[model samples]
Target: MLRRIVTFVIAVLILGALAWALWPRPLAVETVAIGKRDITVTVEEEGKARIREVYTVSSPIAGQTLRIDRHAGDAVAKGEAVVSIRPVAPGLLDARLRRAAEAAAASARAGVDLAAADVKQAEAQLTYLRTELSRAERLASQGTISESALDKARLAVDTGAANLDSTKASLSVRERELERAEAALIETAVSDSTCCTDLKSPVSGRILRVLAESEQVVQAGTPLLTIGNPADIEVAADILSHDVTEIRPGSAAVIGNWGGPPLAARVRRIEPSAITKTSALGIEEQRVPVILELASPPPQGLGDGFRVVVSITVWQGHDVLAVPVAALFRQGDAWSVYRNVNGVAKRQDVTLGRRNNDDAEVLSGLTEGDSVVLHPSDDIQDGTSIASTSGAQ
Candidate 1:
């Protein structure tokens, strides 16, 4: 009876093992068929939306910042006043200049008066000298006047001419002084009145930053504000130097997350210098900065310094054999895919060319109708069986 029982147990165990080994199994899987499609190779980088023109309003002369007309994000017009500053004191240099001008004017008036008096005295002397000379000439012609008397008359005429010349010189000096004083007064008055000047905007744009406030004292060359236009913008993105080889001017780009829908962009320029940047992964990366010009008008609410996500298209091809990136596995330096054939997984070595984030270009070893496993596991080996729920096992 014991022998029979043991034999029965052994038989049952063997049958159960055989049944488990031959049982049909199901696989949790996602798969896609290979096909000819478009493929694009791209490099993605984070950037910021910045205006094409940024004008920094700086103090033209040293003074106190009296008032600010606009704040950050305020709209400004060309030739509009943005800030007004007043000097600590009416320009001392200008004040001294005014006083000097007043003194010069007073002196000029005094000289004019003196010149007029001299002119009067010269006219009186000339008249007396002419009368005396005439009398002496008449007397000499009558032979009653001496030769000495005639000589004296000639001397008097010459002296009168010298006196007139001296007076004319004095008058000329006075006139020049008056002209100089008038010019000086005008200049001084203008300077004193302009001790407070209203600063104006140099361009039409929105205010980006305001660095001054009312009643604040500012030094020479201090920056007061910044303004820029958002409608015209440029996106500067840094690309890894390794990936920059395929990127050139005129490449296409897509910008996102900049307070608007994705905007189309085009590469306008490539920086000549490369910069070293540390990535978030703690790796030192050599990056080249590329400048992109927006191809369309920016949407509303977009402003300067807005962060954006950029995808630069380095290369693209149409009607190319493409495969999902998950379907590929790296074997040493080459690529391979696990294709489903007759309910069995067949490992086929493949040659891949350009690859993007989601797909890769299949250069060889893939047919248009072949279905490949996405993310095949190690449990799936050559000739391993698979059961597709909708189709076959």
Candidate 2:
């Protein structure tokens, strides 16, 4: 009787061990506590720095451009000669043309001589008018002539002076015509010689590019170099058209990933036009450019066309309840998070206000110091047992 009783107790103990082994256990997960802090919503995009004002130096007249000694990034001062160009000499004229030029020059010279004679005649008349006016004044003072006669003499002198002044102007015009005629007659001798016309720099800045470097004959208004002040640099970023509505002038921004610490900046303008661009994924996107002005001087090594990453703060709040984005998921039309209630995962519907890439602002349905499961899997459900593990907030 004692052996049978002991055998039954052993069987019961074995069954209890098997039942415990087969029992379901709690799922291990990562959890973080909700907290209050500042949260900022931003839009990040790639940008490039460029000079605010770029000036292109072009040839003023059609001529040969000399070799440029200054290269890209060379500093230049205002009015400093950057390029020297010599005008091409005129082609040699035929005999008939030469004779005609000579004849035109002779006629111009004759005109000059005729003008000189007229000037002399006018000078003589002016002298005579002055003498007559002086005599008339003296006679009138002495009462030797009537007042009407004195007035007549003064009028005559004034008329003569006017005529003399007109003749002098005609003489000057004739002389200028003669000089032009002489210039036309003097043919420019063409030779393998260098006559440089120095073109001065329009503004003080660094050379951005050299369009024409070698000795070449370029037409009038041909671009020679590009210049701009690197210190006056601004960042240009293209943002998707749909995302641009939230951005406004004077919006705060931060520039980073430019090989140094992030720099502070602000939005200065938003372009009115939109540009269609093919993205890397082969999708067409409409983008608008936003201009950013740096709040401080850029660090060393930052120059025009330098690549940078820009983050524009569209919304921000201080001392706001927030949680990691991983803790939240879409539950039908509402957002939901798994809260840790006494080691049990509890589904809680949450109202979200603003969110960024990392964190989301909790408007309601969450409180500070509340532990919540991060990246909860499908196994986690209401009243499901859960064990906390190390994870990022």
Q: What is the TM-score of each candidate against the true structure?
A: 0.68, 0.73
Top-lDDT structure, candidate number: 2
Q: Give the per-residue lDDT of model 2 (tens digit) for 206-300.
A: 99999999999988899999999989989999999988999999999999998888999999999999999999999999999999999997766
Model 1, span 1-393: residue lDDT tens = 999999999999999999999986755555678788898888898987788888888988777776675678788899988788776553434677778888988888888888889988998899999999999999999999899989999999999989988998888888887887766666322343565777888889889888776668778799988888867788888888988888989999999877667889899999988999999999999999999988977778766778898899988989998888988888778798888886778889998889898888888889787888888888787788876432221
Task: Provide backbone clash counts, one per model.
Answer: 0, 0
lDDT of each: 0.83, 0.91
- The lowest-lDDT stretch of 10 consecutive residues in candidate 1 is 186-195
Local error of candidate 1 at 371, Å?
2.1
